[model samples]
Target chain A: MPRPLTIEPNEKTILYTINLKTLFPVRRTLTEIFTRAPRRYVHAVDGISFMIEDGDIFGLAGESGCGKTTTGKTILRLVNPTSGVIGYRPRKQLLDAWRDMGYEPPIIDKFGSIDIAKIPGKYLKPLRREMQMIFQDPYGAFNPRYTVYQILEEPLIIHGIGETREERIDLVAKALEAVKLTPPEEFMHRHPHMLSGGQRQRVGIARALILRPRFIVADEPVSMLDVSIRAEILELMVEVKQRYNLTYLFITHDLAVSRYITNKIAIMYLGRIVEMGDTRRVLDNPLHPYTKALIEAVPDPDPKNRFRIREIPIKGEVPSAIDLPPGCRFHPRCIAFDQHPEIRKYCRTIEPPLIEVEKNHYVSCWLYGTPDEVMKLIKK
Target chain B: MSEVLMRVEGLKTYFYTARGIVKAVDNVSFTLNRGEVLGLAGESGCGKSTTAYSIIRLVPPPGRIVGGRIVFEGQDILKMSSEEYRRKIRWKKISMIFQGAMNALNPVLSIGDQMAEVFMIHKGMSKKEALEESAKLLSMVGIDPKRLRSYPHELSGGMKQRVMIAMALALNPPLVIADEPTTALDVVVQAQVMNVLKKLQKEYKVSIILITHDLSLIAEIADKVAIMYAGKIVEFGTAEHIYLNPQHPYTRGLLASIPRIRGEIKKLEWIPGIPPDLVAPPRGCRFHPRCKYKFEPCDKEEPPMVEVEPGHYVACWLYAKR
Candidate 1:
């Protein structure tokens, strides 16, 4: 059996150096499958790196098929990465438990961080309590056969939490109450179908929190919900984050939703992150051409601004990920490509490195220039 | 500009289900102008989609347009026979971008073949002439005419939706009904698609009835707005009047609930509880259970729609003159 997993207290500075190469064989003939021939690499998540400090809500904002969901799944090791380090500070609950028995886990570094990506398959069980995920579709996420009670209890049963079945039932009841599903008894026996969209999402959140995880990846948590219920669910998520001191990696395509919750935000294009910085700084003053197009593309609700019936900044839909452009992935659709003829060659041929264009604001674009030849082409 | 294009009065659509009759669209009344866009905004199962289906005379199996008059131009559409309506009205005068465009297109047929089918049947054109028209339509929607040979499966979701838009405008229908055209698309692509519709609406002088659950999208493109609640239109007015000075409790709740990209971070006030079941709806106001300002009259007796201002009409006890 694998050694019992335990670690030190989670405080600050959790680094993630994630480099993934996810390729799916397309247009394969019968003979190709038998021969095991390579077609083309999709490169869903190319070389990408970012840090999520403790208690941070990092927003991954992008359009469809941009690999935001893939990035989240990769961090949790739901999808194995070819290479990279996912350094995580273990659950504080386990630290206290391990301390009482007088033991120290050898895996922890000086910063008390563990590379979760390196952990083998069977050993991932203990780490489930440290991190969790909330899927986009509440309807399809849960098992149809399971009741609210069974849904919440299965995680506890897998991890061997709570001494008896009665104890687990009490824990489940508390989890329900925590999500404000009042009088816990009212919802425990109900199936997912009986509950409305909002109520079902509340149970999704409850299931995630029951593990007492320090981190949670909420993938479009409120997208499937109605507008009125969307806000209510967001409020609940915020309250839970504060009450439990949990960090969240909020993934969504809605910029307004991201603006509300995330402190730090990353704008992704195709697969690579085009821009990353403080949420307000990045959204309010977007740098990358892709980011600007995305921001302008977001349909504003303000009736005072109905003149939004302008031409779409970007030319067309994202091209095939497998047949990526040579230099900048977004050069074909970038408005700056036409504006700056001086850097047109570089924009089309040489991929620009993600460099700090401003304090805490990192951008990858030829317009921003290299670290040595830094130049701001389009200024605010 | 003041010309009234279509007027719907006391429209009632009911579904005779095994459980009971579900009054999907109950007494919904509105006017569509000649070349303006009207937004029908509501939550799911609130009967906004039903109203559109009723107008198109395609309210699926159990649902039927029980009582109402859809006066288009001058003549009442309900008075016309199914055969006459099919030959004259449908696709010739008014067309619809179905709610699910992804599933609307034929999988086996090429984009050109499907688009050409519209022209060949409706306009009595040859296959060659229809294909040429299809190419032109594709060009108008910003898709390459070369993609005509490609099947529906070959195109992206946005491209598939654009194909649907092209088909809707094939005959240059004077009026188009888009039921959540951008519902499942990415915001960027959604914005692009809406822009395409807006551009065409101006170029062809066609009025559009855009039915959607997103209020923000409505604010961007709609000339007039109608807020629906549990099978009833709770509020109706010009987009400016409705957004600037909303009177109905449900409307106010909806406006406040949306988080804005360009505004001060204010607390979103969401409406409490779920919408009532249309089969056995609340005796009075459908939204009475969720409205914070609901009083005795709100739940006891149904409130008649009253004109609070010049053009804005609201159905609520607060707006009703005693």
Candidate 2:
């Protein structure tokens, strides 16, 4: 009999465990090299570990400069990681190449994933077909001079998807229709400047979809758009996701948008996820103090809760990310210090590990004890 | 409702651009009462910022306030000489917290120097006195007094925004126009900065014209809201009126489109098309092409502002026919 599978059914498909660390050294002077100066890094992304099942829109939501963008870029190896593992289980065919390489990688589930970090530079090119990125700025992403057809067809040409020019044009038309820019011929001839902001973004989405990749990383795709048009793009994204069966790592600073689109969410503060779980569950019942403040700060449109002057939950401005606070990264600005004085010393000294307080929810706060201890406390 | 601090009657600001005349602020009108927070909410090119520029007489070169009666403090300030306006009215009477003003601070000058310069130039305060006043202003906006000595680069984005707020309040101009003050700041810091603005509005009794694209943010602190579309105030009403019962179709669409943090995830209703070009706007209603309720008169003739209910006005054919 086969060994009973421990992992979830969805886990057998895709899971990414990213832990990128120690980034950049702009200028290395001869004097500094001789003196052996201790290298200082931005720590753009520091030891964040989270996994989502196949077809999950895992949202990396946070404020600007919180390393959410870096996390997405690192996963695609857009920026080479100094030290980390980017584990991914591509659909079917890539497994043969893994075995052919004569590398015995550890299997997370029945469908063993290859460590993208371990994969050599040359081998990584093939994986580009498996993953793609939808950039934020539609205006800057495309060649202003290139027609919509040419822009979409370039990816197909580079990836060598079609045999002839006619086949590529047909493929481009199909891609345009998928994004709802109907009568593809009408849009095909127009340059990037001719399209509206919303339409331009739709073209951007079409370019990403033209590749037909399994995983996509959308970085604030709607932030630059007008309020009236964001919904249209979001709807297109959802429609395409269903049609293509694509999993997305949606990155944004807007939590409301995350709640609207993503199924799962991880709220990053500075360079770490303070809280993460099911989007609705985590947003409704946020566990971390930082998460609580983020929820409170979201500008709600309704007038029922008017005139509260929503208090600034966190104490002061965010501390410099270079030399972060010693213990818990959030302790300095954390309102929990006033609410729970008992954990102040612990919060000051030790960095707490992510503990599963609920079935699916995980939080890294000292206020919550171990699983057994928390269960006993709940029972009482 | 207390006292009419400023009345902008039939304000017509037009830009003589090479690409045809751009009606940036075409026949707009609104009033800002004493200590009132009026939110000028609109999408891009809807002319909220241009209206603000017109108020301060800082309408950029190509654009000029063609025809308007700005009755501020019982005086039609448009009739005042440019020299008189600069000496008494502009900056001294009504200041402005410009768009992206957070990064607009002088990089070389200390926060104190920039802030003290406002006092020294406007209020004729000595350097020693101005520096002392600058410290007090900084603290008022919730920045530490010690940061006054630091340059712009030393301060965080939030702190820089607070410094701008402090400098705006330095001359104690009764009216201040903040154009997208918290546009770039994060939510947590935005809330903090909003708290500072709210405190100033309440305790200090300063009248603020909060201009932003965000309706929810406007709903937070605005006493009244003026929704603009294609350089016209499509809807004008109290914050409650606009939020609870929006009159214009554009207002309703805008409200419905924004995803709520605390509510049912209803299907967002997009306005369907981009805003009309200011150069050559649509024939009658600028929003008619995108409007779901575009009827006979909407495409033919422009509709005048009709008082829908007490203190609520809407410029739409649906209301006009009634």
Q: Score the docking of each candidate (DockQ).
A: 0.71, 0.71
Tens digit of lDDT per residue, candidate 2, span B118-233? 88988889999999999999989988899889999898888899899888887788899999999889998888888889888898788999999999888888989999999999
Q: Assess the local accuracy of residue B162 in candidate 1 as a C-alpha lDDT between 0 and 100.
A: 94
Candidate 1, residues A1-380, lDDT tens digits: the string is 01111122345755455444444446877888899976767777776777787778999989989988988998888988766667777766755655555544455567777777777676676777888999999999999899999999999999889999999999999999999998888899999999999999999999999989989999999999998789999999999999999999999999998998889998888888889889999998999888888888787666754555755567766988889999998988888898889898888887776777677788888776642363232221
Candidate 1 clashes between residue pairs 3 or more apart in a chain or in different chains = none
lDDT by residue (tens digit), candidate 2, A1-380? 01111223354457666555636554657887899977656767877778867788999999888889998888888877778667788766555554676645555445667667677676665677788889999999999999999999988887678999999999999999999999999999999999998999999999989988889999999998988889989998998999999899999999999999999999898888878778998998899999999989999776543477897578876776777787788999999977898888878877666666676677878787633454454355
Could you say which candidate leads in lDDT? 1
True contacts kept of each: 0.68, 0.68
Once superposed on the true structure, which residue ranges of model 1 sit more than 4 Å away at CA? A1-11, A18-39, A92-109, A304-308, A371-380
The per-candidate TM-score of the B chain, in the order shown, comes to 0.98, 0.98
Interface RMSD of each: 1.4, 1.3
